[model samples]
Target: MERWKKRNWGWKFADHLSELYVVALLLGVAGASFAAALPLASRWYPPQYQGLAMGIAGAGNSGTVLTTLFANRIAQHYGDWHIVFGLALIPVLVTFILFSILAKDSLNQPAPQKFIHYMNVLKQRDAWLFCIFYSVTFGGFVGMSSYLTIFFNAQYGLDPVRAADFTTICVIAGSFFRPVGGWLADKFGGIRMLIMLYSVVAIMMALLSSLPSLTIATSLLFVAMMSLGMGNGSVFQLVPQRFQKEIGVVTGIVGAAGGLGGYFLPKILGNIKLATGSFTFGFLILSGIAILCMLLITIVQRQWRRTWIGASGKARAEHV
Candidate 1:
């Protein structure tokens, strides 16, 4: 009887959501796990350390690799991307087997309250700011991660090997620095961290705008990339603090914006490179965006001060 009931329940659960969540879960794990591990495995020496630069710039690029390698390979072998989906099902099958026995969601009930309060977050202007900030931060990380190597090859005249080497170095610096950026945001102030990081990015990008000698350009690029990566984490850290109760809405909107930013940033840079026979405009455009970010933060700073005052005024009046 127990076994029969279990089969019926499992069938219901699977029938409801089917494979969409499973595929997303697998893709997320595979992409993030590989990006984290790939840099750790590769060997880096001085000339070879250039790969590290490429890696740093393009660490998020592991997703493309996973898809191109596994998905494409499966497609070629079996004549469809659908085959890869089936291949992904194996892990889901195994997970289901384990979870069916070992794990269970608590059915505990909570007293109902005003569900309408959840909608209050929609009124917060900072939510829009957080979304924009994340768009630039995470967007820059993933965008540069995929394109940095190609950029180096185009801008610095490095061969494929050297381009990839620099990417590795750059991505390593950015990938790990992200979490640190968020920590600074938590301990210091998120807005303050954003101001500082955006300023750093602006200054560095300004210096980079000229597309100077390769040595200066490469060095400046590295610094700018580092700032962008940190900004990515800092923005996200602030997002949760500001939208604690509306996690799904905040995360979804911000994450989507970041993805869109990533999608377009490279194309913009690549187009600039293609049109002018150099990456000068690309550098200049990024620098300009950095400046815009700085300006936006300045505006937000005033709003933040007003908010603190209003909150404090309310508290004091209540005490009286």
Candidate 2:
């Protein structure tokens, strides 16, 4: 690592473009990873046994806050983080130098991708089908992460630190549940898992809203997070299976939709709590959305099965 940077340290100005893309991907991974965990780090916690559990979860999610707050000052003195950053730059800087130092931009015209091809992909109803269903899971994971701390503090009557701790528990369950969700989907079909998880989430949220006890509410919301995380994995798995030909475009579009849903869930919760002095209505609305997603996925799954079955029947007839 030290030897490589020393060898390529004198990179020129034309080298910045390729290196910049590496830096951008670095920032994307950092932002997405941190966004996945931030709100959990900012909430409050319960007492005794609950506190201990929340503390462990909070510590994992709190990496983002810890890095943001302390890494700079520590690095300013010790320089460990910078050493890693310098190491990351080695490939980016070297590649740009080797390519640009000798090669010219080719004169041959590059073929353009057709807008109609992307439009044709967009027109496929199955594409929108996954978008709707996955939005619940993706939205729930990202949204709940954003509002989990605030929602717990407000709904469950914990102070900021305690709320953060409970939210951390939710975050922990959701993050870990992602892998478990994928495993479950693999064993049982993804569509089946999505239906199961979304149903559980809707039911849990409704139950959470009505619970007067903080302990009960916290427990139910934790369950909701688990379901939401599983639903996210299920939705993506379904997306790839259903839209195998256009997985990349469908993934990007559906992923963005899910993120958009996450962005809105918190704001709506805040408004509902403020306007009505109750979270029951808010929970009920989200439950409705989840139910709708479940229904949509179920319908899509049926249609897909029928289409495949019909095609197989025609093939068998031809053979006979």
Candidate 3:
């Protein structure tokens, strides 16, 4: 009887969302799951493994690759976008069942803090800094993921299928490299890794602003997305170290800022294109933000080493 009910809900849930606005609402709700993931990962893993644990979980963003690669083709083939939503229920149901069976709660869960405590957390400078850093890194990664297909279609005259293929290749790099970023941060230091990653993004975005050839543009975007993905991992690596007890609230705030950044980036680019007849200013502005973040990190690392993580940005032995 329980199994039958689950199947019935799944079928109706996917089949009934006929409106695009409803789909967008559902997607927003689903995306909020990312905020829950890192805190759970931090609770389950030791400080030394925080980055890797969060990165592995965060790599779920790669689900975007599946959508980019298949959704359009599926819609075109069926001549109806609604069927794509219905087919999506298969993976959603599978994940739900697997999580229900396999997931475990960590024993070291922290006591819940009061509302005032959370509000005070917002007063801390570090929390805002993390929010800003994530806004740029995760923001750039998702923004580009959402917009690249359109950019390719408009700029290079590629058909929807070909443009989506290009976007998938870029998204794949960002999605998979997230874990690598965390591993590197664990081995070296999150701060150091992010510094290098931001430099890469700054350079790549600047080059891309030139409106290079199709091959050159794709190569640049691939590199930029990889850096942004890694930067996302690196930022989270530092967050738990700096605010272990407040991980849940802090992660939610930072994650929301990243989402806002993602929302604005495409709008900025689109508006720039309309106003100036080119994407040059938008890319240049993004590049400038990267440079600013790099400089900010360099200045802050000195104080950070003294106050929290060691000189190398690794979690202190006692903290771990």
In terms of lDDT, which candidate is strongest? Answer: 3
Which sequence of candidate numbers ranks them by lDDT, best first? 3, 1, 2
Best by TM-score: 3
TM-scores of all predicted structures: 0.62, 0.63, 0.93
In the range 203-314, model 3's lDDT, one tens digit per residue, is 9999999999999999999999999999988998899999888888888999999998899999999999899998889899999999999999999999999899965578
Ranking by TM-score: 3, 2, 1
TM-score of 1: 0.62
lDDT of 3: 0.89
Clash counts for the predictions, in order: 29, 11, 0
User: Which regions of candidate 1 are displaced past 4 Å?
Assistant: 1-124, 308-320
lDDT of each: 0.59, 0.59, 0.89
Error of 1 at 64 (Å): 9.2
What lDDT is reached at residue 44 by model 2? 27
Steric clash pairs (candidate 3): none
lDDT of 2 by residue, 1-320 (tens): 87446443422212356765766565555444322222222122111121122223323332333333343444455644544455445655785597568644323212435666655777878777766775677677767776866776776677655666666777667766765665565555576777788889889977776745877877887789888766665554444344434444555677657767877888998898899998888889998888888787666666765653112111112211
